[model samples]
Target: MAEGVGRGEILLRPLPCRAPPPDGAPVTGTLRLLLGDQLTRSITALDGLDPANDVVVMAEVQAEASYVRHHKQKIAFLFSAMRHFAAALEAEGVRVDYVRHDAPGNPGSLDGVVAAAVARHGPAHLVMTEPGEWRVRQMMEEWRETLPVPVHIRPDTRFVASHDDFADWARGRRQFRMEFFYREMRRKTGLLMADDAPAGGQWNFDAENRKRLPEGERLPDRRRFPPDAVTREVIALVERSFPDHFGTLEGFGWGVTREDALAALDDFIAYGLPRFGDYQDAMKAGADFLFHGLISPYLNAGLLTPLEVCRRAEAAWAEGHAPLNAVEGFIRQIIGWREFVRGLYWHEMPDYAATNHFDAHRPLPAFYWTGETDMACLAAVVDVTRRTAYAHHIQRLMVTGNFALLAGIAPREIEEWYLAVYADAYEWVELPNVHGM
Candidate 1:
């Protein structure tokens, strides 16, 4: 067994130490608050925005970045994406009040920065899409009561199902199984549906998607987005500000803009989807991503919406570009598993985070962070995670997650590691996944 470390005892590389309030100006029309994840242009918070009088607030704050010692690449990706999104809004004549994480007199927290923006712009109301995580939602609720202006928390329309929609489906049910929810989503969206029936006359092809990789099986060359000028600058900032954070920024190829994210989606549909189903669950030596759609980070970051991605996959199937099994499996992941977990999160949070069903209390092993271990599968997954800040679902579930479970690692410790290590991980998604495992 690997040596265990105490909770919050993970060593760091050591970094420089690092905020305040502002004065009030005349009240304006609205002050829109855009979190890093709320990068979509058509988000409800930006609805009916007035460029002349209203201002949008986007910030890179210390409190969010250091909340769990996030991966360096994850920080760079979000910060760069936020910067690009802000610039896009500015180009469209929307006035944006952006706060850099390294800017002088930064408030260093989401609420603090929003308060400062309220004082400076003095808007009549604050508008924002509801946050994904329960903790952040609680913070927004506090803002509603404490802020001097009215706050309008809009539903994040990017998701296929709203919280109420999920709650309605989950109401009085004895169990919350994803397969049943997935069928309902299929019926609701009419994706791969034929009149009143599923396209393949079935709800799931998951059993067909579990084949192991044959000898010398070929893989697609996944697209990589080279960091542009804005991304480069953000990378430098993260390197300087968070020298102690996990994961390296060496091979950081994730797209940091909407356009780049779309390109990635197209690339996956063309090259990765056809083979994705057969080998999505198959793991091989030295193959980090085998026919996997490497777009989760983009999806989670709001660069790509779940509905659009599912539609594209459906289109590929209709156009005969990919097989039905692959398309169905991919769609299920987004609309079925992804949506179900999100709904379950909102349904059971604030209590769910503390539910340790197995009561596993072993500390996380040091190899999880360093990838130094005799177990090849665990070592490989951790190594790739440290280098690229990514791992496919199977690798996460079967290797690292499985090891933690069997070794009896504490749920909170492993949960923190999952949240800290992956670019796509957020509390809303990560907590449910880790808790389930």
Candidate 2:
């Protein structure tokens, strides 16, 4: 564990510090753009990049921060994580050009920043992994034509399937259920696969994983991290700048670095994973995170990869620390529902954004904003979301999302609500869950 720092006792094992990259070195290679979500070193944008010659650009732009009414805690977590990632890259002798959102005379857009970087460094080309949203991809297309250097948009290789691979898988299928897709992913990753068969003789344990919380059952101790110096600075900024946002910044304990994320994963494996499936669908009045690994924020932010998380769960099963039902269910979520939703979003987007098969056209009820409904379940989950910017999948789907769909709420309105409220809300994942499934 690292030092116990900031508001509360958060024992975070900090990544080893290295000397920062010096300036005025001759720039001879590509200038790669790293989005806030794309913080990993293994991303294709930095492939074959020379730390001495190449430059990496990361920014906190106002346009993205204010694109929607994001929870104040959500903004603080992402901004702090991005800052830490840039510092980590710079310490590894790579030149990082980090632009702050409040920088003097800074342009409020990513393309504008890229244009300035090109003028300053004069790189051979610009490289980036494919962006998470269709909107950003369109922006990149315009940049390719106008920028001084050739722009390369590489495939984001973090997933088991590429866009082309998913397109191929989806071509002739009339009905796109997640089970068939998940089986293929299982085969591809060889996760829980025992040669020609699945481990423990089943492909899915979903039926076995749906037990509710019994009368007085217990949940293991949840690991919480206190905001470090970088995080504290971000929290202060968010509190000052966006005080009226949807959520509070009081319990801001997400792990912003890879080491902290791994520690969270370890905590889940030891405490949460064993009982995860048993209570995967459980929802008591006051219980917020019951046996669920609340690591989606880190997973979405690129600090923790989906594959790695799934692998850890499978390892727990193999070592007999957790049962097969729990491990399989957890793995299925990462390789199954998560990947399927992303593929569906990308495959059907631009048009997918317009999906309203049910023709539900009611405005979101006032209770969604204030959690003031007479319904105890609805009010409880919304209160949790308001305070922590988190609710388990069941609360999101069954309680909140179900209410929206049943009342015939406008799809876009609810879409933005899910996007703005959750810590793990991103278009690639959130849209399909809201509009399609």
TM-scores of the candidates are 0.93, 0.92
lDDT tens per residue, model 1, 169-263: 99989988998999999998999999979998888888889998999888889899999999899999999999999989997899988999999
lDDT of 2 by residue, 235-298 (tens): 9877877777888899888888989999999999999999998889878777889899989988
**Top candidate by TM-score:** 1
Task: Kindly report which residue stretches of model 2 are placed more than 4 angstroms away from their true locations once superposed.
Answer: 1-28
lDDT of 2 at 332: 89
- The C-alpha stretches of model 1 lying farther than 4 A from their native spots are 1-28
lDDT of 2 at 358: 94
Clashes of 2: 2
Instruction: Note the Cα lDDT for every prediction shown.
Output: 0.85, 0.82
Q: For candidate 2, list the clashing residue pairs, or say none.
A: 2-12, 2-13
